[model samples]
Target chain A: QQPVQSPQAVILREGEDAVINCSSSKALYSVHWYRQKHGEAPVFLMILLKGGEQKGHEKISASFNEKKQQSSLYLTASQLSYSGTYFCGTERGRQGGSEKLVFGKGTKLTVNP
Target chain B: DARVTQTPRHKVTEMGQEVTMRCQPILGHNTVFWYRQTMMQGLELLAYFRNRAPLDDSGMPKDRFSAEMPDATLATLKIQPSEPRDSAVYFCASGLRGNEQFFGPGTRLTVL
Candidate 1:
């Protein structure tokens, strides 16, 4: 099933902070975040595995709550380059089977100068 | 750096025509996925394969759509008698088991 993303769209000034949330109805084993620019393919940002772990890259970070079946992406001191559509792909159950990822509708983030 | 590559970045065809899209996954990756993106449907998983073997293709329209991985490096998605509603950006992603997937540039297909 497709995950749900909050705040379908968000506009922010450079250096501002924003949070994008993704929630699933089913239990998730991992959550993968990606950013896609206009007319471009989605780029991998980070992946949060189970165990309620948090990961970060530069000013971007994400937290996965396995128990809550939710994940939140944090962008601090956002840069103009951060303007794009962010998607969260969720994986359920163990690996080795049909480990296909179901993605959310995506959150459109616009960072202005 | 290794990256997934797709052929025919853009394809325009008339209705009832046949369209084929190909992908070359990153070396050492065992899993390949095909996804279609549209304004209404968002990102939909069409099919996926692991180690050149199809794992699941229930999301694909079996009537006109087909997906196959002939080898470890090559994967193909074909649509016969395509319709205008099939117009969308198709993406190919590859990854290891339980790892982050790397996506290709995507093939923008427009069925007129």
Candidate 2:
């Protein structure tokens, strides 16, 4: 089953902060986060492995809760460039086991300058 | 800066025609995924291959759609007797260790 993302859409001003959450029914080994702009493909952000692991790039970071089967992405001091749609993908188990990924409906964020 | 590459960025075909989309994954990436994006369904995983072997394709309609990886470097998704409802942006992605998925620009298919 596909993961569920909360807050289908949000609007924020530049320098603000926002959080996007993803939850899955099945146990997830890892959660992948990405962002995409209009008329463009989704861009890789970071991956949070199970076992309470965290990964980040720049001002974006994410954490995965294995027990809860949930993941949250934090965007601190959001910038105008951050205006885009964010998607979270869940993998059932470790790599080399399954190549399939279930993605959320995506959260659209609009940051105004 | 290696990236997944998809051919025919945009394809427009008549109904009942055959449509094929190709993907060239990043070098050394053993996993490749195919997804379809629509307004209602968002991004759906159509199929994926591990070591060029298809693992699961339950999300894809077996009758009209088929996905195959001919080699480590190439993968293809084909649709026969395409219909208007099949029109959507098809994206190809590649990843290592299922960690970070790198997506291509996507092929926007329009069936009329």
Candidate 3:
């Protein structure tokens, strides 16, 4: 099943911080975070593997909670370029080292200078 | 950097016509996925293939849409007798198992 994202939309100042949450009912082996600008394709940000690993890219970080079946993305000291829609993709179990991903509806974020 | 490439970045066609979108997955990325995006549905997975073999197409509309990986490097999604409701941005992504996906600049299809 596709995960559910909270705070469908958020607005933040350029230097502020924001958090986006994604929750799934089923177990997820991996969770991926991506950002998409309007009229553009989504760009991969980071990936959080199972076992509650934390992955960070620049000021963007994410944590995966295996027991809770949830993941959260943290944007610290956001920049104007961070204004975009954020999506979380989750995969069930690994299948021969490959698995299909289900994506959430995405959280729209806007950063104002 | 090798990235997923999609053809016909923008297309506008009349209803009932046929539309075809193609993708070239990244080298050695065994998993390929096709997704449709719109304001209402956000992003919906249409189909996927692993190692050139179809894994799941349950999200696709079998009646009018068909997805196939004719070869390891290429994946295609086709819609016959297209309707206005099929208008959306279609994205193609490729990745290794349990890793970050690389997305192509999607094909924007508009069915009038």
Candidate 4:
């Protein structure tokens, strides 16, 4: 099943901050995050693995709660360029050890100037 | 600055037609993934390949949709007898590991 993202959409001003959450009903092996601007492809941000280290890039920080089967993305000092849709893809344990990713509906974030 | 590339950024076809979308994965990447995006359903995984071998395609409709990876660098998704409902954006992604995937610009499909 696909993960669920909260706050379907959010609007923020430049320099503001926002947090997007993702939750899965089943146990997630890992969570992958991406950002996609209007008419563009989804760009990889980072990944959080179960029992693994959390990662960050630039001003973006993310955390994964293995116990809660949830992940949250934190965007600090949001810029106009941060206006886009954020997607969280949850990976499930496969039969043959292959990885399959299921993406959420996406959280559309709009940062205005 | 390696990135996945998809061909025919846009494709328009009528119902009962065949639509084939191609993808060229980043060099040395052993995994390729295909996805379809629609307004209602969001992003759906159609299929993926590991080492040119199909890993899973249960998300794809076996009857009309087929995905194949000809080699390490190439992948293809074909829809036969496509209907208007099939119109949406298709994305191809590649990755060396399941931890992250690099997506292509995507192919916007419109079935009239």
Candidate 5:
């Protein structure tokens, strides 16, 4: 099933901080985050695999809680380039399911300079 | 840097026409995924292949949409008797097992 993302849209100024949350009803083995600019493909940001582990990319970070089947992407000191749509893909820990991802609807973020 | 490549970045066809899209995955990547994006449905997985074999295509429309990986490097999606609703940005992604998928510049299809 598709995951649910909070804050359908957000507007922020440069250097501001924002948090986007994704929650899945089914148990998730991993969470993958990507950012997509207008007219461009989704670019990989980071992935949080194990539960209770936090991963960071430059000023962006994410945390995954396996028990709750939830993940949050944190953007600190946001830059203008950070303006885009954020999507979180979840992978179920099925026996043979390797990387089949079910993605969320995505969060639209606008960061103004 | 290795990246996925897709052919015919834009496709426009009339109703009842046939449309085909192609993709060349990154070398040595065993998994290829096909996705369709629309304003209402968001991003939906149409099909996927692993090691040149189809694993799951349950999301695809069996009647009109078909996906195939004839070789390790090539994947194709074809639509027959296309309808206006089929217009959307189609994306092809390739990746290794348990790793990040590299998406190609999508093909914007417009069926009139």
Candidate 6:
């Protein structure tokens, strides 16, 4: 099943902060975050595996709560380049099986100068 | 500069026509995934292959959609008698098991 994302859209100014949350009904073994610019392919941001690992990339960071099957992506001091649609893909099952990613509906974010 | 490559970035066809999209995964990538994106559905996984073998295709419309990987580096998705509803952006992503996936630019399909 597809994951659910909160705050369908958000608008922020430069130097602001925003949080996007993704929740899955099924247990997740890993959570992958991606950003898609307008008229472009989705770019890999970071991946958070089970065991509550938090990852940071530049001003963007994410936290995974394995127990709750939820993940949150944080954009701090947002820059103009941060404007895009964010998607979270959830993977379920153990290692070595048909591990496919089920993506969320996506959160549209706009950042102004 | 390793990346996934897809052919025919844009396609426009009439209903009941056949559409074929192709993908060439990055070197040494073992898994390839096909996805469809629409305004309403977001990103939906259509099919995926691991090591040139189909692993899952439950998300695809079996009646009109077919996916195949004839070689280690190539994957194809075909739609026969395509309908307007099939108009959407199709993406191909390749990765190793349990690794980050690299996505292609996508094929924008328009069926009129």
lDDT by residue (B24-97, candidate 4, tens digit) is 99999988999999989999999988889898899899999999987777899999989999999999999876
TM-score of each: 0.96, 0.95, 0.93, 0.96, 0.96, 0.96
Candidate 1 overall lDDT versus native: 0.92
Q: List the residue pairs that clash in candidate 4.
A: none
What does fnat come to for each candidate? 0.91, 0.91, 0.84, 0.88, 0.56, 0.94
Better of 2 and 5 by DockQ: 2
Kindly list the per-residue Cα lDDT of model 4 for residues A67-109, writing each as its tens digit.
9999999999999999999999998775685788889999999
Report the C-alpha lDDT of model 2 over B1-112, residue by residue, as the tens digit: 8988999999999999999999999999988999999999999999888889888898899999999999998999999989999999999999876467889999999999
Off by over 4 Å in 4: none
lDDT of 3 by residue, A1-113 (tens): 77999989999999999999999999888888889999889998988888766554766777888999999999999999999999998888776654667889999999999
Better of 2 and 3 by DockQ: 2
lDDT of 5 by residue, B1-112 (tens): 9999998999999999999999999999999999999989888889999898888898899999999988887999999989999999999999888788899999999999
Q: lDDT per residue, candidate 2, A1-113, as tens digits?
A: 88999889999999999999999999988898989999999998888887767665866888888999999899989999999999998889855477467889999999998
Please provide, for model 5 over A39-106, each residue's C-alpha lDDT reduced to its tens digit, 9 standing for 90 to 100.
Answer: 99998898898645544366668889888999999999999999999999998974666567889999
Off by over 4 Å in 1: A53-58
Candidate 6 docks with a DockQ of 0.90
lDDT of 1 at A95: 58
In order, candidate lDDTs are 0.92, 0.90, 0.90, 0.91, 0.91, 0.93
Candidate 5, residue A109: lDDT: 99
Cα lDDT for residue A19, model 5? Answer: 98
Q: Pick the candidate with the highest DockQ.
A: 6
